[model samples]
Target: MSASVTPGEPGIFERMFPIRERGSTVRTEVLGGVATFLTMSYILVVNPAILSQAGLPFGAVVVATALAAAVATAAMGLLSTYPFALASGLGINAVVAFDIILGRQVPWEVGMACVVIEGLIAVALVLAGLREAVVRAVPTSMKLAIGVGIGLFICFVGLRDGGIVVNNPATGVGLGDLTAGPPLIALAGIFVATAMTVRGIRGSILAGIATSTVLGLVFGVLDGPDAVADWPGSDQFSTIGDALDPDNLADALTWALVPVIFALFMTDFFDTIGTAVSLGRAGKLDDAQGELPEMRRVLLVDSGAAVLGGAAGASSVTTYVESGAGVSEGARTGLASLVTAGLFLLAIPFVPLITVIGQSVPYVGDTTVVPAIAPALVMVGFLMTRLVQAIDWGDVQDAVPAFLIIAGIPLTFSIAAGIGLGVLGHVVAMTAAGRARQVHPIMWVLVPMFLAFFAEDWLSVNVF
Candidate 1:
């Protein structure tokens, strides 16, 4: 049955979003949007918290995160007419922070410029009709492995951020003082979030972060915020437009960074395809060919969001898998995304509260601090790992590469390195198995590129 409308007259939302045609109501869409916002809102705190460690001001990142999410999510709704909401992706942001920015010793502006470059590439691929081709070129096992490996990597970071893991001179990494105030708060947060998730509670991750923040305050591990809300000004948005600077873009376009850009692009590309496909399936929105309606538009907006997010210094915004929450709440159209976008915009004034939630608290000593939002990271990492079972462990050719990715990412603390190793392992394993003919031509192309990427430092000095 079509959605009910006022007798003989459809409302504006009905005309704009075609709610009746999609078998949904404005009320339902609004509810689903709120559900999605709640489910993924943890990014408001977590994204800035992670980026701030890379020298971004927490307040500015907070503004950038909210504005980017609001704009991107709104565009998704209005342009694609889909319910998927966009935000700074967790794993991608981690790569920007730990690998691109810190590991490469580049300025944060340059790191963000990489996001813009990858996003523009993604846009070009979509427009040229090559996005789907690229997706098919990758082996299914490697794709699944990439997500699983990133999940483990994110979880490892969460553990460290929460003081659950500590550096040890003897063994590299060991357990931290769980009995300590900050660690205890984190433990309680993890437990609460886990239980809430198991109980099917909405916004459980955000709740977990809130719980930890409250505990930190009570235990004196965190200081209280001076205000609940503060109007943000132009000066507060210092991170905005940083990615668009010519110098940053030029720096990011160096010859040595080509592989890095490809790596980031691959992550952003595959992740959106996976999330959109899964959400479409769950919502029964896919057609006979299993393609969602307006899929091209969806991809365009999601890809462009990476550019917007990076320019705003919020990393690469992509379609959130948590949008499945909205889908589950019976959202079938972009109206839901519009609602989610509005909520994100409404959240901007509460930056002070978000800052407090993301604030770091002293841990082992004055030199050590633990994030209040670490539990959200831990929970999100667990959610991302659900794709692991999709890998065919029985096949040695696939398993070898999958294992390399799963183990290498966290162990090496480098997403790019892990992906490179996995791709190399896949090529070698397939050749060894006498099935080289079956490997995609693209995989072969990537092998030499990855080898060069791995040897970039040596080549820079010896050859370049």
Candidate 2:
């Protein structure tokens, strides 16, 4: 519990941050920020590794990821006067790297353009107060299903990345060589993270990655960068900026990508909102209407951060639920986030140290596999699965759409498609149950969009 300090008696740094008024000390806020950073530092390694698969430069991605997150998080604190930290989100990165850039074969630049579009759209929605409407318009079932579907999708990515699973021409996907060194390493990392979690270790995920990297070195599967640590020497930072060229967006945009943009927006939209709402509620920051204070500034910062992240050649940035860790440790204001931002800036000296695991190995049938980061992806999936138990399984109407989303994501390997199919499923199931009138009108509007989104490619392939 935080003790109250006199209102007008400002100490050094107190007038600006008002840490004392918020019931926190500089020391307490500093400790809280450190705690939050430890919890999320795994992203410094995992994100670039994943995004690199989409043909991005891993080292530059390291700098972009840290710098983007630091700036956004610091803005979140200064703008909202809240302790929330922001970062490039996990699932959205998978969708960008796997679904759009690789699976859909869209250029990474164009994929980034879509992220910029998502940010612009978000800014419009926030300014117009339409975000809340959209959130309500999405049926509860579809909302829950989105999380579950994405969880499965991320898990599948991890499995394939580490080559623990393989494409089976006879069926769909199959188990890979359990005897393979890469898969074994991934499996061991997963077990290590799981064990540390069970043991209540702080920074368990980061520890797991470190342990796996060391084990990989021991088994002669992991190789260090030609130069272990050195001054910056690449154009990776320009990767995202190069994507913003209008020609790049034009080249990337096709009928198939309309839904991809919407999907990217949707994931970032809900993730930020959910993180803010849940963390705010826990922190006692909600009003009688259940809205957080200074929400407008928060939304602006969130949307702007997404745009900045896109330009930085990273994933969509959003408020981190990990901020809760800091809040729990006595972070009552933005000082904690400021502290975290500084730490991120301080990590710049070790960017090469973080890139060691971004490299993948080619093996059985010449498959390229990113073994090191696979464990982190799988662990993220596990964290996402917590929301599934909140869904109402007894109601078939809800169950149908939820199941479609959960099953369709990994099966189709497309986040946009899974969401579209889930919407269709929900609408159709409700109509069959004589509850069509209960469906949101926005959903009806989406029916045509979803149909067109699905049909565009087929129509293009088969018709004029």
Candidate 3:
């Protein structure tokens, strides 16, 4: 009877996911999900560590992180049928906690309320198709360049976070001592993973991270877990955003808050776009228009995740580029994301294992080092770099912007700025070459918006 059933029905997992067409199975997808989750699970602890600085309770943020990420990612799989997982975004969290809450003296409650507001706006834009329109208006070069820029930025983050890249007062950045234990292990993982990748092996990125982690444990670089689990108390749960009052919401409606909201929106918008483009290209999953299939739905889910995360007392959430880890592992369907989401929920009971293994940072004098996760990021960055060849490098108008995006992303340490600069370069270069008439009107509109972003930055530094 089961074999007699038709394939057109949606009830069957194989029918819905089309595992045969994707050359994937439940087993492969499950393994891929585990790999992807392992690569980015550091977010579980990192998000709390960052947000707690804003007076949010650490344990509560952990629960919130898992809750928000699990819900968003599960929705991604079931709604958009994408393998991507969503989580509290890195840059957006910094904007929320560091810039908005700490620097602007806005309480964490107000900042989260703004995040909810931003997400609502995003929902409107996506549902109205304006978000897709703006994305399509961007020049092809700019889109491809944004992908490359994010790839470079990921590598930069890996280097810095791994303690392989250090600061210098004389110039800007200097190399870390390769002789040190933490950095040396990172370098070793890099070499090992690069070799495995070159050999066309699967799961090289996750494998490298595991090998490095084992080494860290053996060398006493990574300490054991402090506890088996630390369940968040009532004070930790639902504490943030609980203080959001009518007065604070009204106060946040002032002109001063516009720039902050705009900045938050821009960063979230571009980071999600860049990550999507790069991941799509890597998987050969996007349409010829450089848009993912059912992308609007994906954005809707992403925006909704942000709102839910903020309301749940976590930071802004979005789709993760670390999904590439799963994609590379042959996860061609939503089942992979479902598996990853399940892991996130399951890991809640093993908080100690998570913190000790994936999120550990040992203090070496004044600096704290995370030796395991950084190498995985570096490996993933290396893998994502193959998207660069898709750019039209022969045209100087194209190449210049591409180069700016690729370089500026890492140098300026801002993904949104990198995308903006790339667009700016493309428009100016095209106009200078008397191709102004051929340029898209959207570029003209966007150029000014990007300028406004910079201008706002200037005014903040000089005027404010």
Give all TM-scores, in the order shown. 0.97, 0.94, 0.75
Instruction: Give the alpha carbon lDDT tens digit for every residue of 230-264 in model 3.
Output: 76556556655553567666666654555556556
Write candidate 1's Cα lDDT for 164-278 as tens digits.
9988889999999888887888888888999999998877887788888998888788888889999987877999998899999999998667777887888899999889999
CA deviation > 4 Å runs, candidate 1: 1-6
Arrange candidates, best TM-score first. 1, 2, 3
The best candidate by TM-score is 1
lDDT winner between 1 and 3, please give it: 1
Q: Write the per-residue lDDT of candidate 2 for residues 1-464, one digit (tens) a residue.
A: 99887776676657668687677888888888998998888888888888988988888889888899999999988878888888888888888898889977877888777787788889899999898889998877778788888988888888888789999999889999989888888888888988988887767677768777877888987887676666665664566486579887676566677778888888888888888888888877788999887888888899988888887888788888888889889887898999999998888668767777767887678788878888788888888877899889999989989889888888998898899999899999989999999999988988888898888778888984
Residue 54, model 2, lDDT: 92
Off by over 4 Å in 3: 1-62, 80-85, 88-118, 235-296, 310-316, 319-339, 358-365, 457-464
* Position 72, candidate 2: lDDT: 96
The lDDT ranking, best first, is 1, 2, 3
lDDT of 3 at 146: 58
